[model samples]
Target: MKSQLFTIAIAAFVASLSYARSYANEAKSEQRMNVLFLASDDLNSWLLGDTNRYAGKVVAPNLTKLAESGVNFKRAYTAAPVCSPSRTAFFSGVAPWTSGHYHNTPGANSSEPLKSALSMAGFFKKAGYSTAGYGKITHGWDQGEHWDEKIGHKRDPAPPGAPLTPSGRGEQDWGPIHLAEEEMNDTLNVDNAIHRLQQEHDKPFFIACGTFNPHMPWYVPQKYFDMFPLDEVTTPELREDDLDDVPEWGVELTLGKQKYVDSVFEHGLHKEGVQAYLATTAYADAQLGRVLDALDKSPYRDNTVVVFLTDHGFHLAEKHHWQKATLWEEATHTLMMIRAPGVTPAGGAACERFVSLLDIYPTLAELCGLEPPDYLDGRSLVPLLRNPEAEWQSTAITGLTSKGGPTWHPYLSIRSETGRYIRYVDGQEEFYDTSKDPHEWTNSIGDPEYASVIKRMRAAIPSPSDAATPLPEVLKNTRE
Candidate 1:
């Protein structure tokens, strides 16, 4: 009895000492980072030198400057093809399959949002940081009431083209614009974001400014449209038989339910649509410059951690499809850039490891010295940022669920460092190799040469499926 009492007394003393030590450290670490999260619409890694900065592509000068001062994640991917799920994953630190959100929608899914305070805005609030979101916060909603404060912006001033509202071909009267700038519907999101950032706040904050240029309704100001003339632009090449070598599942996805002005695609939209997308992208990049400008002038500039990404990717008649919603590189692959006070490497170093957007939470936690909840699906990326050349896990997964219309393709695909695997619900499949076919033109589903490869990728689907809507039937027939 005497020994027990002695032990209890000593334990109490140690606990008190530990608490004091923690308190002391917390005081010193109070200099936490302010987060400046820049989310652009439909942006992709290919545009930002995430993997390789192509010689012919337009360089994002501001983004390049950011890379010079931070690390760029080359193989990073979004959780879903559209905006909502991707943003949800980042805010919630969870994947779409688990969150019951795989499309760009406004409300809660059957499951809680990936991050549960209903949104990431709430997460920051609980951590004692002021949270503000501008631009596209939820897919359709402006900043939510959940944020400590919310503001919004919209791109263009005109009504959506005729195609979207009345008849599918109604917008043909507006002449033509590329895919990106056409979505400039309204709200002056950039200006609102800047205004919100300039407002005084009681604590360090999480400021998310989304740029809409690259989403859809890809219409840009006349000034930016003139910057890239159709004559000087060369269409990114496509092989006439690009789909021949690809698996049926892969080819099937590239074909979908997109309509052009007056049903003109069968006649011709490749020229009018594709080049406009390129131009619109250039304009979007310019808007990004605006947000960065705001950050450069803000009081929190020195202490902020800036992370940028797109919801997913777009398909401009790539597989013969004009909209988003697929598991291919053009749909799942994305751009992610992060610059923190003392953590990111300089000179635009590239991290080739496959990382999911869900990693954003833990990575920010590491940089800010905060504790992350235990249920997150992504691991911290601090190590990868520090050493971009280090070894990492081989594959990154992406999910897709249709919003509406015919669902003919696979919903889940696992992209390895060098290959891709598409699995359908009814046992169909598609596969590709990055080394031999960067555009995923060839389908080798039943090819004997790739049987072992198929076997390996097939083994990767998570033991317990995270999504209920399995891959579609047409996609399955393409599998080996």
Candidate 2:
């Protein structure tokens, strides 16, 4: 009888231990914060902060409100200027030079470091959170497999008689479509986010909603276009002789898009294009506003951490270029806002420290009480979030990879608080004192006064040897 009692006691003790562990895990998950990750494609700093280039031109009340509610990094930059590479670099927590995956067509699927690194959603899912993603989180590769629930991105439907602009590049056109707000793809993503917020989640959640508007072929409802009258739209400041002082590669970057610029001038569609872009941006903001509204109404509002950013900035005729892929300020400088409920200062704070999208992985990991993998190249921005005026000793590095000849060329730029230094693959250099020349029209690499500044910036750039991985087979034939 005693032996049978002893066996029953052992079984009970083992079950009790298992229950204790499960209870502890449940409590830990409850204590942790939920994350709401929001992203916009090809969004610039125009509507975000006090120091943006276009101060009052944009009609983005939602973006302004969100910026007012969080720590807005005024100097936030992308890892790369292009969509695919920038998204990959930030999502993988690896630098572009390290991955050697730069273009949209060929991605970093083959990069060993990227393949091993835990994606943002993957990390949260591993930490027992229910992860769901919608819209353009990972650009070319949607990364649907990484999330427990995913709704792949869909582009806004093209209105009848599309190509509002008559450029040969059809996707470059922009105008308003006739679809209802509920019919837009971004609206669908926002609706998904709203529905997720409304659901009763058993565990902490990581929800990502990405908006694809304001990227290209910018089409929204007619009401958005009506918001920005074509006559009232002002084009970005342009220097007619901007290319005079640029390096050969830099000039080539502009010349490559000369056809688009010529088309704009040829058809007198400059102001029209600007109006379309602003309208599309406003449309994106509206979707974000809906998501924010749902969150505000949901039970998880106070406990959820919200992060909003863009994959990269777009160049609307700045630097004499019409698109991204150039390592210039216009293409790299973007908007990044984070609101950690109890941690961030109420009513928003502006962080002027130079930060990169690459820092997001570690920052979210630390914010949610998860241990970050040591392989991440970015440091946690939790300190900056807690204290916006914190002293930061880092500069944001943005790069672009283009094949100039037989080998790929990595164009790199280091952006500091006071200046910017760019180094092309062929050893050509350009340095600008951004504090004095915000437009970066003058290249002062040969100037003797800034020799030490250029030297330090040059030393910070990753060596060509560090870019060991070659572009995937998709990009072998043509230059990006």
Candidate 3:
């Protein structure tokens, strides 16, 4: 009887050991999924396949192809209209208002509250993943410690050309350069990213490639410019009275940057400027294609989760605006696409639900089976990835501080599927029934019929106390 009992105990111990080994193997497999983050600067949603009017007008075959493979968000918006604040929101999983990173102030990661938070890269690094960043990931913030390897502020040589217009906005100038595509900064960045992908790694990798093209100065190769002829190039539909219904503060914001509009018209470079923007966009697209192709040929393509997005949208003479920093659709709406290896549905579907750049952090964390920090203000997008038609109730909020002195208040815009509502700090409001007026030409805030809609949208805006303190006067009035 003693021998039989000893034998039974040995069998139970062996079974327990097998279970432990199985669990360890499963965990390792879970950790092996890689993340490839691709970012663009100042890329508007209208330049891609999101809108019917611009569809097939822009030359972005790779982006279109990538969209076909995964889920594209049709109505993704940035937390803020500028670079630093928008990127800060995504990286920290916190909104600009909550973090008080409303301006182009760099080193936001070192700020209060966010100083203790685990950045997107930091969180992945802590989870046994190798992280590397290239190009302009953060707006001038030195996040060198967050990555295992980092290449910061890489830029391409200025295109070899003369001034098209004496606007003095050197970076805003656009022309064709004489340099080869391979010699461009974006190409070099992609080359480095591809090299990393080709190497075998002991741990999964989180590679970030931020391309800085089409951002400003629109200088690219002549071939790209040739793609869009001066005569055939189409500009965003503009109405002379588009801003007629805008509030006084909103009008002030537009008038503050009237110089750019004046310059564009004064030099007869409107179509040329549009052409340059298109050329730069194409150049960015080519760089994207190269990087994506490298990944496809690499061994880890199947196990990687690819996310592509722009920092924020750009305004190419839309609403009489020349650049970003507006709550209008042209400035806040951006391009967001995710190609999660297993979670996303096949055939490149699109989710029209209103989503924010802030959601990217939590969505990526959840996709990799990691628990996102509790302080995140955005919701996980896993449900939408699983089913594009998933029931979702969310609105995208974008904020901008007016261009006045220290006394100016910030304006917040809440974007829903049906309409967009803007509430100024002084209680002045603007509402657009987007279902009828897609361009927001008319502000219907005074209409009694939509009082309930205004009430609902107003309720969504976070209280002023939850927002970060107003940026100092020195940091105010600066253009993005």
Candidate 4:
């Protein structure tokens, strides 16, 4: 009888030990580094330190502060220059070319590879982290199910008469709305983020806060407008014949949005438009400052990996364009900064490598010790983070979705440290030696002196079979 009791006690003790091991595993996961992903809408590189073209012309104090504490990617470019495709490329770890989602019509969640692939939020949730997203993370939060908690964003309220600037298309105008800063939509979004940061989490968290200012209808409080005087606003450098040397395909993209610029100039809203964008950007920066302050005060400050980036760059009459969707520097060059505690440098660092938003997925995965999917198109930027001057050889590729149907073919832009090379489907090309012609006023495609460079860039274009995924038959007409 004593021997039988002894055997039962041993079995109970062994089971307890196994349970303890399981508990320890859970605790380990809870101790992992947290992630604070911040995104801004329609922001350009004008405010990026050491890479700012509009130095002292834009007021983005919070963005400047964030860059001072993290690694600022001076030459970051978007995978696609449009909103839906750009966001989809980063969050889905799939490029627009692969997904065949070149436009904003068909939701990315409905697309194939994006539909099946594990998203950035999903990957974190699977790795035992609590994922929460506020504001515009994915295009309309199409993959909303991945988050343990999620909140969608809304635009700033319009004034009584609306369309304050009296130019441009739907939600294209910009001015100060007669509202308090706290009453703004972005402030409310940041409120949710601050609340999440204050709460106690049993496990590490992945929090994404996105602000939608500096986008269309750039509505913010009157105080933000007061900060940027209209007379002091600096307009982008422009040439009367900027497009005279551009290829037919490039000209087509510009003409589509030319009406907006024409209307602005006709109505004399040029300075007001520039002022509104800067004011709206400053307002967005203020909202971001709130979240950053909250993080600094919270316990997660020491361990959280904070990343700030915009979906894509906006064109403020640069290249005679008013908005995104072009493959030019004004449309594709964006702001990207990462602050990984103990991983990135103390004060800050600037990396000049040609990186893309597509790299964010793998970089975050590797930083958090999570396994990235095999199908990711971007390489991890860990080495660059460790040493800002690391030897890296990579180019950023931006694709413009083609108009659908039998003759549909996507346009490709390859950006390297040397220059930018754009290739259209008809074999027409445009090459800009950005080193000498920053405004890209001259197209060097006809110059025989750069023939070898053109050939090398042309070879980098993906093959026809691997290029664009054909848009689904049903959705092609909806957009094109």
lDDT, candidates in the order shown = 0.64, 0.81, 0.79, 0.81
lDDT of 4: 0.81
Q: Of models 3 and 4, which has the larger lDDT?
A: 4
All candidates: CA RMSD (Å):
8.7, 10.6, 9.3, 10.8
TM-score-wise, the better of 2 and 3 is 2
Candidate 1 lDDT by residue in tens digits, 1-480: 999999998998799578546744763477667788887777655575324322235547777777667888778777777776677667776666555566654343544333242356666667788887777655642226558656565445444443432323422222234334434532356666677778776677888877766666655555655665766654444556665664455455555543442253566555555555666677767777777788889886777898887777776555655556777777788778888766676555777788888788888776666666665667778767777776678578786655542222326788876588877556677787777867777766788888988898888765324334332321132132
- Find the 10 residues in a row with the least total lDDT in model 4: 471-480
Flag clash pairs in model 3: 68-348, 171-217
Full-model lDDT, candidate 3: 0.79
Runs off by more than 4 Å, candidate 3: 1-29, 49-56, 106-110, 160-162, 166-168, 403-408, 468-480
What's the residue-level lDDT of 280 in candidate 2? Answer: 85
- Name the Cα RMSD for model 4: 10.8
Candidate number achieving the greatest lDDT relative to the actual structure: 4
Regions more than 4 Å wrong, model 4: 1-30, 49-52, 402-408, 467-480
Tens-digit lDDT track of model 3 for 93-208: 76766666665743465446465556899889988899998877777444568798887656666654556456637566767676788887887888888888888988889999
